[model samples]
Target chain A: MTGTGSISDIEPRLGYSLRVNGRDHEVDGAWVGDSLLRVLRDRLGLSGSKNACEQGECGSCSVRLDGRLVCSCLVLAATAVGREITTIEGIAPEDGLTDVQDAMVTEGAVQCGFCTPGLVMAIHDLLDRNPAPTALETREAISGNLCRCTGYGRIFAAVDSTVASRRDAAS
Target chain B: MSVAIPETLEEALQVAAADPEVQVLAGGTDLMVEVNFGYRRPASVCALHRIAELHAQRQDDGEVVIGAMTTYHDMERGVIAAALPGLAQAGRTVGSPQIRNAGTVGGNLATASPAGDTLPVLMALDSTVVVASVAGRREVPISDFLVGPKRNALGPGELIVEVRVPHLRGPQEFLKVGARNAMVIAVCSLALVVDLERRRVACALGSVGPTVLRAFEAEERAAQEIDWQTGRLGDPAFAPEFGRLVAAAARPIDDHRSTAGYRRHAIGVLAERALRRSA
Candidate 1:
């Protein structure tokens, strides 16, 4: 974090206010170039969202900004000001795991668990958009979240069990 | 060092005019990738998300005026899909749902990557890029707008406003040859657009050249060989010949993703397939 006497030296650090997981906080030391992923992990101490690939190619840092699922690594923290952000930490109630999380555990979907949070957030987003997603739809929904451990089979199974359980609950 | 979130296009333009070095940020799909990877470090940034004008879409007569900041997600499922299905297909082939939600048409055009999925579609449809600055507004044809790989015809302080695509009465198709299904850059791509009213057929090649290229000879030959009444090629042999001509028009070079020979061959296959699908 060495400032090379560049434009950043002339520009002062700005304050950015963000509402994350229903809690509002102001980041006074937030740099203009800091990403939402950086803010969440470092400034706010919400490390539930993993930062695997800083670029948009990997969805390990997926989060909901204004209800749209996007790679938090790609979103600038400055632009996220006043926007409601929902990370993986915000999914489950205080007392228990979310349905998706429960299904993942039941189906043994998590291996190394590095991609678990992103997968859970992505699956949550998918089921929210399409309640009764087909097998292919489920795969397509989580296509962005890559699990290098090659645990796609169990992940698909987790989605299936989640959908079936939700159907059973509804019935 | 600072981000200027302009609420209006006028304010954006004013900010741009004030600081020529200010990088304009739309969806940040491309720019942020560079920034995160330490490839780019801009002194200032002007984000256009708050400018409502850059996100609006409207239908004027037979043309679809899509604001530059419209996301790929909106393009794939909205009036854009009905207006230009090929562009919609291109939009769907872009990264994943998250990337599509943040990636924008304007950003794609501004990046002007040779493998940009939307470039060939815009070129085949004869789209126009509308840009504005403090000086004035101007429209540049898609072909003229893209100068080379990662280069566009944007001047200092100029920002893209919208894209104007005419609604033609014919079927259109876009095809891309990528290594994987999703979140992969194209090895090569092709787009075919037919205009039945004018008895014209146009094809554009992507990633096989420095810029998206129009297969002029192949387009002319296809136009002459196809039966305008039935929307079919009269001679079956013309398909392969047209494909070869399209391939011949490309100026591809060997790269890590693919070789020049493969790109030339793939563009031919894609061109022929696109033509057949459109017919």
Candidate 2:
């Protein structure tokens, strides 16, 4: 990445700190044009968030910024300095997979697995907000996460099973 | 490139005013796409998400004043939805849950894409866009605010502060014809609004013109032929007439998403459907 000369001549490397997965990490010597997704995977060594479409169209880079689902690819690394960001790696338990993750494996929803992390993040967001989302709601929630394999039937099934299991456990 | 994350609107305005070439970042939905695609490489950026004033919303009299930073997710629920159902409906159709969470109404308006889902609704509602600079502020009507495809009336060193839309006592409807149900840009869209108090009907068409186009003749005809008391069309024939007139007002082109002929036909159908549903 060639710098613009004038701005880069003064400071070719910019430094900032970000709170990620309940931990603070200081990122140094990053370009101003780098996105949060780029910084996370390349600088912070956090690869749970996949960088599929750098544009906001695909949810492969989905993460929770301030507890709201957003594409990390669209977030400027400089702008996310003091915000709370939760990526797919942050959703797991200390020892086991989350309910959504477990269901994805059991229901054969991990065919290609490229979109799993983002799907997990989106599903977690949906169920966190609506414990019992309808089929259409489930589809609408994860519409951004595109999976070429499984035809999304198994994903939907996994979401249903997770919802049912959680309800039963609660009762 | 230099980046400034301003926490206050005044500070943001000062930064922006100091450098007219500085790019104002709001949600980074549209701008980031350009950056990612290598279409834009801004030398300086002024991020506004940290500013509290640009994220506020309030109601004054019968108008809904929505802060520029309000996201599509915000518009899908609560007071904004109740006050402007058409805007809410349009907002719900924008992108996906992830995109909606980060994409702001201000970004949508500032980007001023011809296919922006909410532009038609704002035009139909006669919304006013409030833009601010360190010098002062000014309100531009929605029609004048959108000058052309992917262009707006925002001046140098100016940033969108908020949008003020009249909360009318009426039934409003927004309809879009896209390639698919989800995550698709509109080929053509229409928003219809009936003001009960003023006994007026207004309609706006999107993606079928250089910018969002208001169907002035169709609105006038619908206003004249509709029964104010019953909130129904005085004559059923007026529905098709309204559709034809709305289609006539559109200046669509053959693009990758759709053909000019298809967009013209779709706009007419959507306009008719919107009117029928609202009535």
Candidate 3:
């Protein structure tokens, strides 16, 4: 199986199954040129991943494809067939914010909240790879994620506190 | 519109051979931007990232063969980084971690952008680009592969398979001047490779010409001026002199990114710094 599943009965250029947030979703009638970001939000109705810059310059459309962080705006929806996709909606706990999200809320890292979802994704990716990323490492990891609000000082603080609390919980 | 996600290199080549106009998507860093901006409306796309052979890399004899689909994230660390430090350095300067994870080295070469980070390093490493079509495979020297700004030598059905680079035997450096440290394109860049085994020095300049350029005069002069045994320049003044020669070889233009004069001057300074850093 090429894993595209089936073509649209109505149209020639559409149809694919994307395993997103641990569920297989049959996406139909999406434009062949539509981005993964557009499909995830418009087709799958997962609107948590923001759409700011259609280009990859902005991380507002960031998501994890098989655990690697990538800008969904740059990924073609059809090409993503059979790949595991995780969005901001998938990252949240069933009842409340993750530790990283809680830290951001408590630290006032979010101001406008447009860049928050991507930042949250990026932060979790960093900590998952490096449980104790240094200040410089943390900044470098999220350098792709730009937040005009709060000037990023609060964001850094939030990441630091998350690391500290994670360490405390472990001990 | 149709999308062909070929599982094998042969399948991909056949897809391209049948439809020469089929747009190829590797990492989507450059191409997707065009797609997003509506600059390109591809009737068909051949996504090659799924072909496992395109992502394989191996060390053979004295050279490292890197598959075309190798991501910048792959180049950033592990065996590839250790074998090709200058390539690693250049790769690290690419867009962001997100971009690196998705952007492939072949995409950079195929795009053939003069500002492409990996070009100068590949040139300095004396690399060869291996491209294949249904007919057969051919190897083109890096210099010949990159014909001009944002242009390459890829034929109608040909696709890059691998890049063969000699294992580093000595100090190498890649440096660039950008508007900001991260996620910025190069205004001007330099790659310096000191081959202690061959007692040779090669330097390539980027973003200061229509294509990545070898500073032949600079390389020749530096080859004679350096002590191969110690990997040090015989004369301290040679570094600056080498910079002058490198800058003179460039054909920079007054683009929005930088003035031609500034590019020339920046490449000169960059050449000097890269040489000094290697020392």
Candidate 4:
């Protein structure tokens, strides 16, 4: 047998209160088995997180589960319990797009746009951890993610410029 | 259905022991993939991730007792890397950061795959497996625990509790050949433990056999025949014999990823390198 059993055998009742997108929202009707990715997009109307590979490979459904970048698509909504989840929607404070988002657009880091949201979430996490990462570090940080467009040269530059701006602002 | 997440080690152990058909989950890097891909269907599952006591490391009586829940990251950090150098090197190669953060040596031993990254390291280190059940706990050498590929001596209700590796005699080395560097499973991987003071050597290979295997004959040949004085394997004859010994140990089969011939060749090469490194 591939696994010990199927997840279909162990569904729980869905009444957990999950704080998402900087707001406390009760996932009342969602099932115990609903993925955090689905809950964020469908219930919370935070559609920025995409579900390309729910298996944690694509990195498309990436989000910050309590500040740790995780595959939201792979995470069960029940696991959230009372953790704060930060999707792309929660990245900027009502001030429009954040500096990182602006850098991606200004530097033409946006490609076919399918991988953009995941890239955004990943880079935000990376910067949050290391505000000043080298080019190689930046490359290594996002190696978990796959980008089909824009050969990543401009994307790297975009992140680099954003970091430079953040450094200057800190100074 | 959602598997029950037991919060305590005793509760988790009791649940696992009580449920005859329950499959244990820790990290879920391997089993989860298999389940998601329609490989296995477990009915009742017990997750051991949250248990507090399982993630421990201690040194007692010159043997390093690594808790079953200890993550690969934990091994890479401190005394674990010093006590089990080959195992540490192997851990460094297992999957990516996320996978390493989640995977554990306990899970590695339980899976008992021929290609487990830590298996060769454990075998070379003469690691001991501590299996726990409702009856009691039993410790078995890795040699006896691994019956074949994807098989083990573990009985139902028994789970691997910890791996005890004796302190290394000297610095050890590990190397693997795979499709690429990051997140690649081994085509052939080997670990070497070099005992400089005692003039002894141990070598083990993964992915060339039905299970992770030891080159015991090769190790003996090095100790008895090879020249530790000159810092080299003295007998050219021993190299051929060692190759033969290692290749003979291979229970590898022809598959899409590799040919039997390539596996044999890789086994010999890794055996030679590991032996020489230990020397």
Candidate 5:
């Protein structure tokens, strides 16, 4: 347990029950050292959250833990037990997409699509916290999210469109 | 292999006392990186995020006591920023919103990285680290708490309970040189504090030595040369001299991030700029 290895080699198998996407799930045979990202993608079958960088540097695995955006790769699955988790799959309605997602689609912000879910979640969190953010604010909000494609021009456009639509809806 | 989520300080201490090998997890900003990179596999982890007492903050006497679990996000706003603006500024420059939301000052101190953004601010502010165990509690100055790079003075079973930073006497400033603006580690960082009450000025440098270092010679010269009322040195020549002394105080080494010569030069420029800003 004091050295790096597969989670199974670190500890005996265990079960961790967690709530994800407004549903209760009991994940069994989970490795004690498994990260929340691993459990979400492997055990729970939630592939909406990508695991590009297991490190916190890349925001590819961004998810909401108890309503706060966090890097899922950094959180231990055991520590997340009983906590509320909202992934990219949980953000939108069953049949439709979130406003941020919709704006991203309309703005052609998706190029490779690997980083889109994280950018979408990051923007959603930002707008949830700050409804009317300036362009600089939007850039700062998504600073952690790295988009290797589209040169971020389209991403900024997507954010701008989402803000405009939100204001229009409010009016 | 197991994570112990303690709801109380006493329980955490008790768990630590029972198992000295247990690693304390505050925000998991540093530890998780190590785990993710396959650098460490801790035998056991004591999760301290649920400890309410570790998240409490209070003003006692003339100082502010910030609990160990106070996140960088907390430092960027509210009373913590008002109490220690330099520290708050350093916190704002750490990583991004996601990292700041989960990174804690106590965790940064415990990691004891020579490049830690908050270390210089803690050194300049003359803050105190409060450690607790089942035995009792004790306070250690920030200078003594950090022993070396990635090392600290935490004893077995002892936990950093809180950090006590004295209320600001005057303006303070923190400046960092990095490869980029956001989500970058400091190549060389500096913090300057003006103490009008004591008529003294202090400076600290980071990422230039084995640990955060105080430019004592520069501090003495600045304190004696600067006009306390105006917060500026009478002669412009003193500024560069002070910067030279600050650079002389550092013992930087060449690494992938930067060269020793560049680090020394950056510290000098940062020192002068910090002085001008403080003035």
Candidate 6:
């Protein structure tokens, strides 16, 4: 809180115990109106989730809260006291990326990479819900997320590839 | 700032009754916008996230009571889609996916935005908005809740608890003319509910005036004079008259979205299209 100027203008410090990246941690200094995205990125130093739109219009700050796909930018830190948060930084193992992340790279879905974190989080949630989804279903699932760099053909392909790979492995 | 997060309706009522300055936060969709745009400032906020009773939807004997905090996305794909297609469409037409996930029916009603996609639909549905303050709870017709554009009849500590929409045998539809296909505000919007069984119709026009309006003259004309039962509606000649009547009902003003004349024209076309589509 030192480098961050004007603590008086912000909400007071509170405490939150959330299961993040499969580990439980006691995070203190929770503000009243501060978004869960801000707490995750600024407090816990998990900077994978982007804060492109403070409103819920953009999915750059998408995260999984209690296994539900939600825009962390719109959720207050105080409201997320007893929930579980899964961000992009938590997608990797102790060393490298998960299969989805690996597929994203293999399929060339990473362009400017600004929107990739949110897209990845949203896709992860979607895949968790429906491991094998139709193309239309996949489109509907990620309709909330916005990507400025690529034309989205590659990203769609990446998701489709992951779905195919997972199915192939299951067989 | 004090944070009063109540778990139940009674507890919420008690908290709201106790504090006259408490601003009601439902889903934080509209409240967040207000704070970001500096439209509202609250020293204390009463969060209604945990009020499970207000979110319940059940047939209480005869009428369907929908909890005011229900999200728009739910309306698009489920029970609401079957019951009230027009209202469900209105909910589906609101902001992007993220916004729809966060925005609530109560938030839309409380904002009182003339351009709110749900307002005209609610008005045509003749929905009842339940407002609870420290005194007690009372139901106001949707027409009355909309005092003006972005103006409402809510008291300082009042909270919109539920919006009960009467189930009617009708062909209902909602149409909007916005600047874009998605994530755009309405230039002019219309919601038509035709209860063919009762030989009456309810027409509401929004985003064209100070408030969402019921086409009283048109409704009366259709109810009292015109006979849809004894006549033919699917004929090609019916479109023009429907358009004219719908156009006559609107009171639009020129704004950034479109011209008044354009809105009037679009309203007529939309109304006719809505009717035809429902047909």
lDDT of 4 by residue, B79-114 (tens): 888777787888888765545666789888888888
lDDT of 5: 0.89
DockQ order of candidates, best first?
2, 1, 5, 3, 6, 4
- Candidate 3 has an lDDT of 0.91
TM-score of each: 0.97, 0.97, 0.96, 0.83, 0.96, 0.89
What's the count of clashing pairs in each model shown?
1, 0, 0, 15, 0, 0
Lowest lDDT sum, 10 consecutive residues, model 5 chain B, at: B228-237
Model 5 stretches astray by more than 4 angstroms? A1-10
lDDT of 1 at B154: 98
Candidate 2 falls in which docking quality class?
Answer: medium
Q: List residue ranges in candidate 4 displaced over 4 A.
A: A1-47, A53-55, A63-90, A95-100, A124-139, B225-248, B275-278
Q: lDDT per model, in order?
A: 0.90, 0.91, 0.91, 0.77, 0.89, 0.78
Q: Which window of ten consecutive residues has the lowest lDDT sum in model 2 chain A?
A: A3-12
The sequence of per-residue lDDT tens digits that candidate 5 reaches over residues A121-150 is 999999999999998888888988888988
Better model by lDDT: candidate 3 vs candidate 6: 3
- Candidate 3 lDDT tens digits, B189-261: 8899999888888999899999999999889989899877788988888888988999999999999999999
Better of 3 and 4 by DockQ: 3
Report how far residue A16 has shifted in candidate 5, in Å: 1.4
Candidate with better TM-score, 2 vs 5: 2
What is candidate 3's CAPRI-style docking category based on DockQ? medium
**After superposition, candidate 6 runs with Cα above 4 Å error:** A1-31, A129-136, B37-41, B220-234
CAPRI classification of candidate 1: medium
lDDT of 1 by residue, A41-96 (tens): 99999999998889887799999999999999999888887789999999899989
